[model samples]
Target: MEVRASPREYDGTFVTTQFGAENVKRAARDEYRKLIDKHDSEDVLVLTGAPTSTDAFRDTLDEVLPGATTPYVTSPVVHATDVLNQTDDRVVLSDALRRELRHRFLADYEWETEYLRQASEQPSFIEDLDRVMDTISWQNISPEETPELREITAALDAFHNWLAEHDHIERGQLIPEALDVLTGDDYNDIVDINAVLAVEFEEFFPLDRAYLDALTGDCDLVCIAEDDASVRRTWVETGAITDYVSFSESRRASGVQPSTRPAATAAYFAEETVVDDPNTGSVSVLAADSGDNQLATIANEIEELIEQEGWGYDDIAVATKQSGSTVTETIESFERSGIPTESATITGFGDDPAIRELLAVARHLAADDDNEVPDHGLELDTDRLARVGEMDQLEDAIRWWATDSGVKERIAERETSLDARSQFGNVRRAFRMAAFLDDTAFLDATWESFEEMLERAHEYASQQNQTSATDLDGGVRVDHLQAIKNTSFKTVFLINLTDSEYPGDPFLTRLFPTERVASMPDYPGVTDLSNTDVDQTFPTDSTASSRPFVQYHAEHARRCLAIGAEAATERLYCCLYEYEDTALEERAQASRFLTAAYADLPWVTDAADPKITSEQAAEEFLLSRVDNALADVRRANSQDVTISLDEVEAELGEIQELLDKSGVRGEELRKALRARVEFANGEVRR
Candidate 1:
């Protein structure tokens, strides 16, 4: 038997060749501790490409170096921009500002004013403008020659000049300037460090590569390598790293047993008996009809797991491939099922009701004409102010509206209902700041400039209000796959495993396609560009891309559970008839991993057939009506609210006739009738 050796610091850097995520974390922790003890100094800096990994590194540091003040830990971008204070008086332009600049440029130069105006309302279009800027920047070509580019460049320059006049620097200039600062003679004065630990980073941009190269000359460089050999090979080919030794062996820590890997096909069965054993853990897969159905089914399963298996909500986790409405839906469904759930990712402020409301007000005000209402004391009709075009009159109308419309009160109500009220507070602050700016900096501003200011306020609010999922208290953790990395759970439900969803296509921006940008000579840092081509199939020895990485991490849990939706359905009704047609449904093929793992397993057929008999259709309609009526009555009763007696009587009358025709006589009939009467009476009384 070949004995594996533990990772140790050789020369200065320690590289671990562990196969599992937990093993790599343990190895890094052990080596980090040794280095701290050996140096007898705490001037250690830990850097990673991701904020999530930074958090994991900090956790390990807390455990290994207890009582020691937490070391300076941060992502490369944050450390360079914030901790190092590499930026000067120049302020980084917010994404919103960039979009506004692009819009103005397009309107003035490209003759795309109408398109630009319409695009401004779409968040995705705004995002594409950022991509356009990236492509232009990456090519290192001035936009002066290209007419359209000239306009964009002009707008950007204008924004930059405005910032400079205000003694602020653009954020886009941070990286290049920071690189210059670090590569200069005074770099040592800014960053005083004894050792640098880079963990779980698979790629490096040119700037980061340069930064790391400079650091290695003065201090030890320890990097944990768990990415595919090809990824590392590409990094080497790109001159991101010099020759370094590696310790490729499994080093199991004492008392830490490897988690059991269940049969891949275990999850494809309908019975829990096939998936789980009493003594051993198992992996299971769930199927549903649509996204809504998927969430509902998962909620039901979680509720059952908590009750039947006596598992605490904390012991389970729910992860999705994407974040957005799906996350909101999952949380809502879980809450509906009485399962306390919290997200482990920051939701964007774009969806915040308060922010939307504020944007609406801003748009309405900006679109106002010059017509003003006659002053009528404090009772001046605020609605008429929307037609006032003059800046001073609009300002007065805004002030009056702010005071009279109870905007603050409405914001407070929204804040009270939000789980992360701080986010709403930030939005409220931004709205106030915008209002203040309208009276000050933008007093005589053009519509475009005013819009830009609003965008700036929104950007500031979003940055301040961004909430971390880690801060949430105990509940069933609902997070993206990335956030759940390095964390363990007793059971994990990995949903949205369809081919189109899992190992999702790389985000192709307008200018720099992910692949080309990643391969660019002076690209900033490593991205998932190379990993985009990772095979989206079952895991094998040759599989080394993101899809398998996610799968491996998911399978690391004690029990791995996955859910996929087979089809999406729409219900249609013609007059008094209603039916669900599979022909009209859009279906998703099962993930390759699912199909491969359960090729022999029978596909779970839907219980409902496409064609419905007349009797079946009538029965379905009647059942739905009955269910809705009962639910309404129960809700009204619970809230001590009254319902219309006539409506209740009509529903109860139909139910009673059905029972009578079914020949439910004697004490059973009497008891059923009595229960219905009591239920109706209780609702009416309430």
Candidate 2:
């Protein structure tokens, strides 16, 4: 990027920034001089072609070393493009491509009420029933004596009955419906099913079918019966059955399973061995603890590096496997620590208003030319934008993208095909062509439109809703993965890095054909088994005993490891909990080479520090700051002529009251009083 003239004699050095090139011509000359043994100033050749790295190379040599020879080569070719023709060679979509992909993500939305209505009429209605069971052992309290308690009890009974009767019902659908019914009518005595549904609505209710099905189908309800005999009797009477059964009296029955509970919630902490002076330096582990408390340790280290080593916050990064909770916690903690961290932390959210607005403008420009809105036309007005910033209007724009027709149209034009396209043929070609050869004018127009839109959004947010709190920089930007990567940190704690998550499930990933039968050993012909008086399950084809060449798990692991490794730095930390740890470890190993070669940092395992919280330290720190501020104020006030003795006395009384309330009274109070007196005396003299 740098350009300057070179010295008379060809040398590797250029007269600019340490790594800067003289002029393009001089750089070319220098390159040639380095390439050739001796450079004749009069015998230089010049070449030029498309505006690329090649052009820069040629121009640099021609200008710097005048006699340098260069050959101009042109074959009507642009920059080299890596065409992903083979399926194996293809890379996952980039964020931009992903955003485009999202538009094509067939939105098959099914409402809860509607789905229930349609499914209610199906055969095997009771198949959906959870179970019907009545416990004979009841509290001796009379229903008349405790009506409210009785009502609640009765409601639970009714709920249990409904569950048993409708055992065939989708638990996912039934649970929501049951909750809705419970919360709706107090007549039943339990919190209405409808009301309970409302409480957990967002958790189960999803925007897409995949989300809904995944939530519903993947989990099973675990019922623990206090009396198994009673449960079986009730189920038999109600025509309800279970997939499995156990009773204490039966020979097949097993006793209650032993609890596998660790002595402490923090078993890892318990396993830690503390070291003294020689190993006083902090230990580095996988940071497997995903909780906020664990992240606090990592954040504390970063803070230590900043304060002790004098490194900027930007110099260190906090990377997590995915842009999720750990990232959010770390960034929020950083800001809470009074550090002005930038919009780089990959908290699972969206982008900064400034950047988002720019991107919106860019995306708009990248799409089409004719749909320019007034908002997109204006040049960026910093002051006006600042006022908008004050109001925190980015939320409005995000909301618009989520809902508004115009914005949706712009997005759709840039991304989705105007036809019901399959993953083949003309659609793919159209997408590629549109992406590569997008109209320049349209892109410019879109940008201008977005700018104008942002201004309007800001104005509305600020002027109309001043009283209401809008986003004022608390939440972290999460829109783009690259942006997320840019803001990621050193200690990355990835959760849910399981087979069902990373490569996703077979159904979701659609990696293999849905109709493909799961490969299993096929039994061989055993016509002579009678003669041997035995049955054989061996397959005729020995090769059939081996699994088909399906490499789903290995493939998924490779991809996941590749991504994690690519994102990790020298001090990378991969954290997963016991629930997910085994699978994650099996799936991928910690990134190889660096940390092991350099040094080993213990992961500071320990008994959970007796919860003598840093909260207490934080409180003391805050009080100290307040005291310092008070000292400065008193010193200034004593020298000022703006107040009377009455004002001084009032301020003193207030300070004393505050001190008493805070329990920081005594010597500190005396010192403050003396300082105030000295300040007053100085003021009087002045």
Show model 2 residue runs off by greater than 4 Å.
1-283, 286-290, 323-572, 576-686
Instruction: List, residue by residue over 1-686, the lDDT tens digit for candidate 2.
Output: 01112211211111111111112223334334543434243322221211112332434334544444443311111101111111112232322222222222212212134433454354422122111101110111123322322433343354334433533221212223333333343324431111000000111111111122222221111111111111112211111112122222211112321111110111111111122223222223433333433444444545555565565554454434333344455556655544434333231122122334444443444344537433554364444433433432343433333243243334455432311111122223222323322322222223333444333323222111111111123222211122221122332223333334433322211111223312211101011112111101111111111222222222222223322322222233333322323534443323221122113224333222222234323343334444555556676779763435565457657656666675554446556556655665565423
Over 1-686, each residue of candidate 1 has an lDDT whose tens digit, in order, gives 11113322233453644234455567678767877875644677887655545665677667877675776677665665663364364544444443444444444333344544555565565455555554444223354333444544555566556556755444454555566777778777777777877765444443454556565556766766542311212321221122323322323333222233232122331012222222334445566556655665566666666766687777777776555556665666666555667555544354455555445555555554536322222332445544433445334544445556665566666443334454444454444444444543423444434545565544533222121233554577776555555555666766766654533454434444555534433332223322222222112321134452243222222112221110001110000011122566657665554444444433321223223223323343444465567778788989998888689779868766776676544336546445555665674423
TM-score of each: 0.60, 0.27
Estimate the overall C-alpha local distance difference test score of candidate 1: 0.48
Report, for every candidate in turn, its global Cα lDDT versus the true structure. Answer: 0.48, 0.29
TM-score of 1: 0.60
| Model 1: residue 232 alpha-carbon error in angstroms | 13
